[model samples]
Target: MPSPLVVLSHLRWDFVYQRPQHVLSRLAATRPVFVVEEPVHADGSPRLEAIDAALGVTVLRPHTPVGEPGFSDAQLDVVAPLVRRWAVETEALGACDAWVYTPLATPLLDAVEPRAVVYDCMDELSAFDHAPAGLLDRERDLLGRADLVFTGGPSLYRAKKDRHSSVHCFPSSVDAAHFGQARPGAPALDEPADQRDLAHPRLGFFGVIDERLDRDVVAALAAAHPEWQVVMVGPVVKIDPAELPQAPNLHWLGGKTYDELPAYLAGWDVCLLPFARNRSTEFISPTKTLEYFAAERPVVSTPITDVADPYGDIVRLADTPAAFVGACEAALDAGDADRQRRTEAMRAVLARTSWDATAAAMGRLLDAASRAPSAHPPTPTHSSTPARATSTL
Candidate 1:
């Protein structure tokens, strides 16, 4: 009989902007999976019902209230105790055969006595803007405690390999069947009347508008090519819209739900990933890269390490603003036959890098950890210290 498996993550289900849901869905097929998430809002109501419906797994949200101001020492203090208690309670609920903790909840997992521990390092948290201080230290401590560490991309794996003996690269993968539906002639996003009135060939980008975006590059591209309308779709994070320099041709479409992404992808002549070269963006393995390919659209990206790897063939890589603009021009100039060939190549590549494959790799790591000797040694007992000579009234 197989041992029960449990997954711990700090990310809430409503914040399913990441690929945890897809990974959880794959893991659920083999064993009982439980996701321990943070509380969604200040009200204490969990936003995990949709995730429960989607993954068929138990979703546990602790009742602890997040601290005031959201991002202070006070908040961390409020949340940490609750998270620790939840971890302890979850451990007591059953004898978990193995445990996989995503990066955010790694500290909590450290206190639990699971049979095996696997650490999933999906992102370099410390490099992110507004990340908690001492994040890297915490991650290092978690890495030391983990039986195995799994990274989301080659770049991340390379960065982390020196810290852990057992580290593997598992890049972001797409739901091929879902994304493949975006072939030309499929239903596209309804272009806004204003957008429709202005343009013919539209270059688009769809994802979170965060610090990782090279705003200067985007502005330059839009300004340089008045004929091409550059449409951006995603909610802004860490930056105010007013602060960003905008071009007349640039349109911000806000964000769309995951299910509606294919429609937006289908309508674009090309997809762009203009990431600023920084610690956070350097190791990122954007899930949208393959999604764009699956939609049969040409792609242009900044020279991020991971994107420049296996995707160099299908994705045109650029270093500077001028180079990126030139790449976009090249992509636009390419005939439909060239575009289709590249898309086919991308499809073939993505089929091999599926969520099922990622889950299988994780399963293997967990299995090995379950069999391997414990990395953590037992604590030694200490004799009581002699009482000091103290005067008490």
Candidate 2:
């Protein structure tokens, strides 16, 4: 019989940004899946209704809110009880053969006594200012105990390989069929008034407007090409919109639902990812890169390692402001023949790298973990262990 799987993550189904749901939705075909998430939104009240509908997985969110920014005491208050409850619940769910913990909830792994533990390190949490102190230590403990580990990008995999015997790079992937359907005449979301009036060729980008974005590069490009309207869609995280060096040509249309993304991408002449060189941005395998290609839109991105690989053939890479502006112009000016060739190349790549494919890889890792010896090879329990830190995603 196939082993049952349980997924532990900070995010519940309703949270639109979580990538684990995408993978989980794909994995539901092979096994019974259960998700344990933050309790505050436990009654299926979170925006994950679509995900729940798609994945057919049981979700359990605790009634107590655990961690939050700027409140160490509150975080601990929530986590301690949450951990105890999780332990009790996992013990009750006797058929669970494996546990897959996303980074945020890995700390709770100590409570669950699963046959195999898999750590899905999808992002470098330590780099984010909001991440809790001693997070790195918890990650180190988790990695040390994890029977298998998976990273979200090549750079992340390289950075973590030495720490674990079994580490694999599984970058963000897309539901190609969903994105590829954004062809001409597809219905689009109600365009923001500011963006609605803007003249085409619409140069666009979608995703969080966070500290990783190179504002200088975006500003330079917007200013240099006043005729080309730049439309940025997504939530602003870790960065204030007022701090951005905005030009009249730049329009910031705040966060849209995931279902609306393809419609926006379909109308774009070129897609841009102008990220700064920072710890948070370094190992990121932006899911937008694949979505852009799936929509058949050409892409321009910063020289981030993960972004430069795989999609490099279809994307223009730029380091400096001038290079970025030049690349965008070049991408826009490329002949139909070149564009078609690049599009075909990207389609082939996307076919091989998809969320379904990624979930299969993860499934195999869990299968292996189930067969391997437990890492808990009888270490003496310490009353209090000093925090040890490690990287993630």
Candidate 3:
């Protein structure tokens, strides 16, 4: 029987359809995938709740007291025993591979001695607001213990490569068919009521509206171009609502289901990636970049190194609010010929990247690691080139 895989992650499996969901859903085809989430505080006895998301994909949430939701000592105490029992019972015939997205679950290393442990470093967690107290130290520990480490983008790989010898860069990829549905005649089904009345030449953004968002820049952009409508979608976290820049031209469309996104994309004149240049956003690869390209929409964004460096040819990048407004205007005034040329350029790039391709490459890496003999973990040399990965597609 194929070995089961348990993934401990900071991201909720049901939240947004990003890297974790895209990669693991495909992995489920070959092995049982149990996505273990952080504890959710509840009133009852500490117990595990397993929800079946699909065939071979299960979302496991440990519910303890309300205050014990994080990887606090109490939460760990409640989760360790339950998971240990399940891991052993499920993998009696084979050793399960433990894939970790957070080092907060390090206590599990003692409780469940998995055959292999992989750290998928998708973000610089320590830089985020309200980050756990010991995140960096725990990351260091995880680095030493992890058999393999994978970064979410090239910038992240560059930053973390010196810390671990096995780190590899797997930047964000797109689901072409899914996002490509945003064509001229595509139905924008399930359009949120508020978005229906929004004015056009809609300059829109969709994704978590967090601290990484450059609120001042957005406000300035709105101020400078009162005629152009600004639409902000997705949930707001780690920030207060009153703190957001208010303007008559700015519309907060709120969050929408993934299936409903294409409609919004189809209606948009241009897409926006307005992440602020901050510690939290320093290494972000912005999966939305590829998604927007797949949608065949012109995009304007801040100088996010990851997006600017690799995708600069297709994406318009600007540093200041004035520059951002100029880029938006340029995107708006793009002639048919200019638009067609850029569209073809984007398609050529998107053709090389897809969620299926990314997952297949990752599956190969995991299998290769599992089959290789265990050797003493090497110290980071910091200068090695990243390993190449490709898919048959």
For 138-191, candidate 3 gives per-residue lDDT tens digits of: 888988888888888888888888887777778878888888888555655555
Off by over 4 Å in 1: 1-6, 39-53, 63-93, 97-104, 110-112, 185-198, 371-393
TM-scores of all candidate predictions against the true structure: 0.83, 0.83, 0.92
Worst 10 residues of 2 by lDDT: 384-393
RMSD of 2: 7.6
Candidate 1's residue-wise lDDT over 1-393, tens digit each?
334555666555555356777777777787667676654445663223213635446776544345433223454455556544655665534545434444545545533456777677777877888777666666776777777777777777778777777776667777877777677766656654444565647888888898999988898889889988898988887898897767788888787777777766666788899999997797788888877877878899998877776667778899999999999999999987888778777766764567787777777667666765474422211111111112111
Deviation of model 3 at 61, angstroms: 0.3
Task: Please report the candidate that would top TM-score against the real structure.
Answer: 3
Tens digits of lDDT, candidate 2, 95-192: 45445444546555555456777777777878875677777777787877777777877777777778877777677778887888664455655554
lDDT for residue 18 in candidate 3, whole number 0-100: 82
Alpha carbon lDDT of each predicted model: 0.69, 0.70, 0.80
TM-score (C-alpha) between model 2 and the true structure? 0.83
Task: Compute the lDDT of residue 373 as modeled in candidate 2.
Answer: 48
Better of 1 and 3 by TM-score: 3
